[model samples]
Structures are given as C-alpha cells and as structure tokens.
Target: MNDKRKKLFLLDIDGTVALGSELLPGAADFLQTVKENGGIFCFLTNNSSKAASDYVEQFRDWGIE
Candidate 1:
C-alpha cells in the first residue's frame, strides 16, 4: 500500500479473513478496494483441507470472488 510502488497483498482465507461460513467484516471491501485501484494481491494459504480453488469458491460466496 505504497504510492506508485510495487505492492502486493497476501490473504489467508480461513479464520484470519473468514470465520465458519462467513466472511470477516471489511474483508470484501479491502480486496475490492485493492482491485479497483490496480493493486496486486495473491491469496496464499496452507490449508490441508483445501486449495486455492476452494478459497475461490468461498470468496465467491462471500462476495469477494
């Protein structure tokens, strides 16, 4: 989140950014804001129970997909 510099936001989709079947408050807005402003983001997770696609679906359900 620097001015005109290379930046990236890495997000964890489990309890850090989401709770059981629910998205954390401001999580969507935070992502959307970064996307809308041309900021970069990468979702990095080490979930043994799921993968990136799983997060994709979950984020979609939370309106941040």
Candidate 2:
C-alpha cells in the first residue's frame, strides 16, 4: 500500500508574500522549500487595483513562474 498526502499552501500577496514590487525576506526560500517538498503554493489577493496579468508580470520579474 502507498500512502501520500497532498500539500497546499495558500498565501497572501501584498504583505505576506511581497510589498509592492519587492518580495519579503525568506519568501522565495519558503516557496522554494514548499516546491522541493512536493507541495503547492498559491497566492491570494484582496486588492482589485491591478489586473491578474499585472501580477503575472510582477512574479515573472521576481523569477517566479
């Protein structure tokens, strides 16, 4: 028998993951760790000022896909 559990991490974008165009300290590391451990991390934002494409571009600038 095989036993494995899925891991999902729901994170905020503004203050938790980043501030403006900069990513907070250890944020990248934490995300990388999650990926390395076979976990998934998703971003959640309540701000409606920017479009989803804007965030995609921003994340690309930070070397995150």
Candidate 3:
C-alpha cells in the first residue's frame, strides 16, 4: 500500500464518533492525534437527517473540527 503520501481519514459519526445524542469514548482523542500528525479529516455521517452544516455544527460543539 502507498503509505508514503499523507492520508485522509474519513470518520463517521452516530456510533463511530457519537451515538445518537452522546459522544463516544476516545473518538475526540483519536481525531486529534491524527490531525496533529498532519492527517486530513472528513466526517461522514450516515444519518441523512441533517445537512453538512448540521454536522459541522455538531463537531464545533465538540470542539473538534
């Protein structure tokens, strides 16, 4: 695999980083670690109930993205 180039980690919420209305353990830490290491993040949520702005607001509330 080409691990030379930087990677962009696409993480999903609603269980991966959160559950319904609650945050998951270690999720923020993991995201920070990767971000600090120069990795890109693109949050992907399966719940189509909300728009991209909604997701961004959620992350902002968590002080994450």
Candidate 4:
C-alpha cells in the first residue's frame, strides 16, 4: 500500500506573489512546482481595495490562470 498526503499552499497576493503588476522572482516557478508535486495553491489577500473579479482579471493578465 502507498500513502501520500496532498499539500495546500495559501499565499498572500501582495509582496508575496507579486508587487503591483509584476510577478516576484520565482513566484511562477514556485507555483508550477506545487502543481508538479501534486499540491494545490490558493491566493489570499487582506486588501479590500479590489473586488474578487478584479483580482481574477489581474491574475489572468499575469498568466497565472
């Protein structure tokens, strides 16, 4: 029998993932690595300046989704 546990990463958007419209160095690679390792990552934000839809659009523009 084989046992493996799924991993989940909850990351912050600002500074952690990106600063403004730019993606931080290695952020993309880190996320890709998570997927490659059968892990799931979700973005988290404490800023309420933007709506969820706006973030979705921004993420798409950044090639995150």
lDDT of 2 by residue, 1-65 (tens): 57576589999999999999899999989888889989998999999999999999999899788
lDDT of 4 by residue, 9-32 (tens): 999999999998788999999988
**Residues 1-65 of candidate 3: C-alpha lDDT, one tens digit per residue:** 65785668887877788987577989889888888898887877668899888878878898886
Q: Which ten residues in a row have the lowest lDDT in candidate 1?
A: 1-10
lDDT of 4 at 60: 86
Candidate 4: RMSD to truth: 1.9
Q: How close is candidate 1 to the true structure, as a TM-score?
A: 0.73
As for TM-score, the candidate ahead, 2 or 3, is 2
RMSD in order of candidates:
3.0, 2.0, 2.6, 1.9
Q: List TM-scores for all candidates, in order.
A: 0.73, 0.88, 0.80, 0.85
* Arranged by lDDT, best first: 2, 4, 3, 1
lDDT of each: 0.75, 0.91, 0.81, 0.90
The TM-score, computed over Cα atoms with residue i paired to residue i, of candidate 4 is 0.85
Best by lDDT: 2
| Model 1 lDDT per residue over 15-58, tens place | 67777678888877887888888887877667678766777787
Q: Rank the candidates by TM-score, best first.
A: 2, 4, 3, 1
- The C-alpha stretches of model 4 lying farther than 4 A from their native spots are 1-6
